[model samples]
Target: MREFDYQRLVIGYHGCDASVRDKVIQKGDQLQASPKRYDWLGHGIYFWEHGPARALEWAKEQKKRGKLKTPAVLGAVLHLGSCFDLLDAEYTDMLAQAYPLFVDSTKAAKKTLPNNRPLDASDKDQLLRDLDCAVVNWTIEEFEKDGTAHFHSVRGVFQEGLKVFPKSGIHRRSHIQIAVRDPACILGYFQPPSKR
Candidate 1:
């Protein structure tokens, strides 16, 4: 994991209803969205919107103007509510509070895997193990022409044992593939001063 510098973030949640949209719009800096999933009859997804570069610049500016409480980077906003239903977990508070920032950036993140399968007891163990070795830091890379940010990190763990369990009764321990991305990269669309 790597350290990033960003400023001025927009964090929000997008669900199936107007209420979800309203809450995100009210708390976030900007509201960009799309349609909900068919299953989202009354709920929405979420995402955090921000640029790492501009945010850092803003922090510097504030520091110059003596507005900062300390010469430290401002934290990110993560939406726990958005991931709750998506992850099918009743409690993500532990993960959220443990991490400095946890946000639901968009409904796009809620999409289930194409080959969805129910997790059995062995799969559950693998998931817990992978989570324990989760990535903690990230970096943001941007494409100048497209303004698209590519997030990359070196912290994710990939387990490598695909077959061993019984097909019908026992579950196979498929390796976990943790995807890493930089929260800072999301800022490219907004144009942060550091990059501009």
Candidate 2:
């Protein structure tokens, strides 16, 4: 079990339209937004941890897809506030326990578990992470119901793309992600310093 300094605050960066960023800044907080059914990390405001360039890349891609007229990166200072960190063994153990419960719940409901798959044969940047998302959400739900703990956010490091070396866990596109379930964890939002 590796030790983590959960006490330390971290910065998070989000990619979105310039208009959206402006609205959030003007409002002094992020507007309430529903989580997408296909959200990669199960229903929260998503940010790329320490990956401003990745955020910008996503923004540009959104612009190219006509989803955003003016792409921008929004930065935030985050206090994790009871984080469910996947990188840690404690959380992973909780998840491991939750998986069986999740499976049983889905089976009882007569629904198949959502399975993850590649977004496309050639697309390495995105994966269909529905299954992982579902399990995490289920775990949170169970915890809330039992009054054991309330997680304000979930954090994880995902290793994407080709590995940096043979038998290495590190990847060319690895990045940390933070999903803030509670808006209060976001201390404040700012425009990327470079953008200003």
Candidate 3:
């Protein structure tokens, strides 16, 4: 991979319950990391890059579903140390190499490889992506075993839905996502300025 200046900081936004936002502000620390097996970008604290509106939308949706009492957006400044950036061909090539090993391991364990299923039969807006998540996490684990590389975070751009215009691969829901594997990378957090 090309040399990346890990000292540079980037802005990210996260959606959550208002109460959760308040706790982070009061504690002066990042929210707890998520280590779910099916985490899309592997186990980490996820954030939408420069996507405060998107974060708010997600929070509002959660509130509508009764999962959250109040919607809010938290902005963060991240120091991406040794980031595994999928946008770069070098990292992607590395991941490609790791896939075969993952497949072999799963086969040896007599387990079916997870598949990316639609969130709902009628909703194409989202995909489950369990397999993708598994492979990525597995790749990281394998790399760590080698003791040659350690990634503090993973960053990728996802394109969802059809293009807004003809012939354009860009999708309506295209957005950048960052999964911070190391909590120390998050320098600080703040509530975003209210759109209202």
Candidate 4:
């Protein structure tokens, strides 16, 4: 059987308020996991993989929304241990399998399945990922029930925003993101040199 552990270290950037960054880097405070139902990769501390610029952009947007006072980026060294990597066929197939189970569970509980919706009313990108988040959370819970190895992180690629060029497949905001469920997988935090 193929071990799911990725083993290699990768850098991730988290966009947040400047005060939050200061507390994490200067005071050694940990980043709290987001438990929002619409989280793209489920309840975890999320980061943009190797995309500081994009992270900063997100933070700036958040600031505009009054979520933060000043935008900043906090860099992290991460090990994607036993990750549920959506980029791979194996995991995507598993996620597809999990969808029906998730729906069944919802129906059993007399709850309706949630839908993914655009954050902005007219946007094509479904930024509010309620359905995706629910499915991922359900799949992970099922894995735990089966006594399978725990997934420390969930990683996925998102093609978002407007196309980079006319008829181009690439999106301007496309990026790979990681949601770290295991705090231990985060080796250290740093101030990205570019911004220093």
lDDT per model vs. reference: 0.28, 0.83, 0.85, 0.92
lDDT of 3 by residue, 133-189 (tens): 899999998889899788889999888777899999788768888999888888889
| Candidate 4 Cα outliers beyond 4 Å, as residue runs | 1-4, 194-196
Error of 4 at 122 (Å): 3.1
Model 3 residue 152 CA deviation in Å = 0.5
Q: What is the TM-score of each candidate against the true structure?
A: 0.19, 0.88, 0.91, 0.95
**By TM-score, how accurate is candidate 2?**
0.88
**Backbone clash tally for model 4?**
0
For all predictions, the C-alpha RMSD in Å is 20.5, 4.2, 3.1, 2.6
lDDT of 2 by residue, 108-143 (tens): 999988877776788675677888889999999899
Judged by lDDT against the true structure, how good is candidate 3?
Answer: 0.85
Ranking by TM-score: 4, 3, 2, 1
TM-score of 4: 0.95
Candidate 4: tens digits of C-alpha lDDT, residues 73-181 = 9999998888899999999999999899889999999998999999897779989999999999999989998998589999999999999999999999999999999
Please tell me which predicted candidate would have the highest TM-score against the true structure.
4
